[model samples]
Target: MTQTWLITGASSGLGTALALAALRAGHKVLATARNPTKAAQENPQIEELGGIWISLDVTSPDTAKHVTDAITTAGGTIDVVVNNAGYSLLGSIEDMSENEIETQFSTNVYGPVRILKGILPFMRAQRSGTVVNISSSAGVDGAPSCAMYAGSKFAVEGMSESLSKELQPFGIRVILVEPGYFRTKFFAAFVAPAAGLTEDYVGTPVEAALKAIKAKDGSQEGDPVKAAQRILEVVTSRGLGAGTEGFLRVPLGQDCYNRFQTKIDTLQANLTKMKEIAHSTGFDS
Candidate 1:
C-alpha cells in the first residue's frame, strides 16, 4: 500500500536517499529542506525520482506550523515522518558556546519534537502512523568531538524509545535509525563552527576525529540508498510497526553495527554477572 511521507532534511545524504527510495517504493513524499530550491538543485535525483519539495528549516520556530500546513495543503495525513534533518556541530563541551549549543538543540532535537507535536493530532485522528527519527551511533556510543551532537542524538533516541511505547496502544510506531558515517554536505557551506571558539585543539582527539572524517568521507562503506531502502523495509514489516516484532534500535553501517554489538555484548555480560544479585533483590520469598 502506498502511503504519504513527510521527510525533513530531504535535501541531502540519508534524507535525500530516503526520499528517493520512498518515492520509488510508490509512496508520495513531502520532502522538506532549509531551501527547497537549492535542495532540488543540489540533488536532482530526488526530483527525477518524483518528490515534492517544501521549505523547512528545523531550527525555525514555525516548524510545527509549517509541517502542519504543508500536510493540510497536500490533502493527506502523514503516514510516516522521517526526522532526518540534523548536523554535527562538533566541538568540545568547554569549547562550544551557549548560542551554539542552543542552536544545535533547536534543530537537532527540538525541531523534530515539534514536528511530532504537530503531526500527532493528525496521526491520532487516523489512529495509525510511523515516525523514523534519523539518529546516530553517537546516540548510543560516543566518539571524541561529538559531545553536542551525541547529546542531541541521545535526546532523540530517548524520545523515540519511550514514544514507541507511549503510542503503542494507538498503533503508532517510532523507529530510530542510528547511522555512522556517509558522504553528505552536512559540513559544506551549510554549517560552521558555532563562533566564539578557536580551533586550537589541532593535534588532539578532536583534530584526529576531523582528519578521520575527511579521510573516509567519500569512501564510507555503507551506501545511503541501500540504507534508505532498509528503512522502508522495516517500516512495512507487518508486525514491527507496533514495536512488538523486534528491537527499537536499528544500527546501520559496519561502523555502527560493530559498535552497537560490542555495547550490547558488554551490557549482557555485565547483566549476567549481576544476575544473582539482581534476582536476590527481586524477591524475599
Candidate 2:
C-alpha cells in the first residue's frame, strides 16, 4: 500500500534521502523545506520522482497552521509525518548565550511541537498515522560540548515517548529515530557555537570535543541512504509503525546502539544501587 508522506527539512541530508526513497517506492511525498524553490532546484530527483516541494520553516510561529492547511488543501490524509528539521549547537553550557540556546530550542524542540500540533488533529480524527521524530544519540546521553543540542534532543525524546502513549488509543504511532552520526550535510547546515569563550574553560574537554567534531565533520560512518531505507521499511511495515508497537526508539548506527546500551546499563546500575532507598522514600505507610 502506498502512503502519503510529509517530510520536513527535505532540502538535503536524511530528509531528502527519505523523500526520494518514499517517492521511488511509489508513495506520494510532500517534501517541505525552508526554501522550497532552492530545495527543488538542488534535488531535482525528488521532482523527477513526482514529489511535491512545499516551503516550511520549522521556526515560524505559523508553521502549524500552514502545515495543516497545506495537507488539507493537497486533498489526502498524511499517513507518515517525519520531523527531521534541526541543527546542532555545540558549546559548554556556561559559554552559551541565552539567545543561542533559545534559538536552538526554537528550531529543534518548539518547531516539532508546532508541527505536531498542526498535523496530529487529523491523525487523531482518522485514528491512524505514524510520526517519526528524528532525534540524536545525544538525546540518550549528553556528551561534553553538546549541552544545548542534547537538551533539545532530550526534550524531543521525552515528548515522543509521551506522545506515543497519548496516540496509541487512536492507532497513531510516534517513533523516535536516534542516529549517532550520519554522513549528511548536518554540520554544513549550521553549528551554533558560544559567542564568547571564557578563559577558565580553555583547553578543557569542551574544546577537545569541539575539535574532534570539526575533525570528523564529513567522515561520519552512518550512510543517510541506508538510514532512509531502514526508516521506510518500518513505516511501511504491516503492524505498528516500525514493528515498535511496544517500543518508542530506534537507534541507528553502531555508535548510537552502543550509546543506547551504555545508558541502559547506567540506569540499571543506578536502580540496583538505589532501589531500596527509592522505595522507602516513596511511602512510609
Best by lDDT: 2
Q: How close is candidate 2 to the true structure, as a TM-score?
A: 0.94
TM-score of each: 0.87, 0.94
Clashing pairs in 1: none
Candidate 2 wrong stretches, greater than 4 Å: 238-243, 282-285
What is candidate 2's lDDT per residue for 86-139, written digit by digit as tens? 999886788788888898999999999999998999998899999999999999
lDDT of 1: 0.82
- The lDDT of each candidate is 0.82, 0.88
Q: What is the lDDT of residue 251 in candidate 2?
A: 85
* Model 2 worst lDDT window (10 residues): 237-246
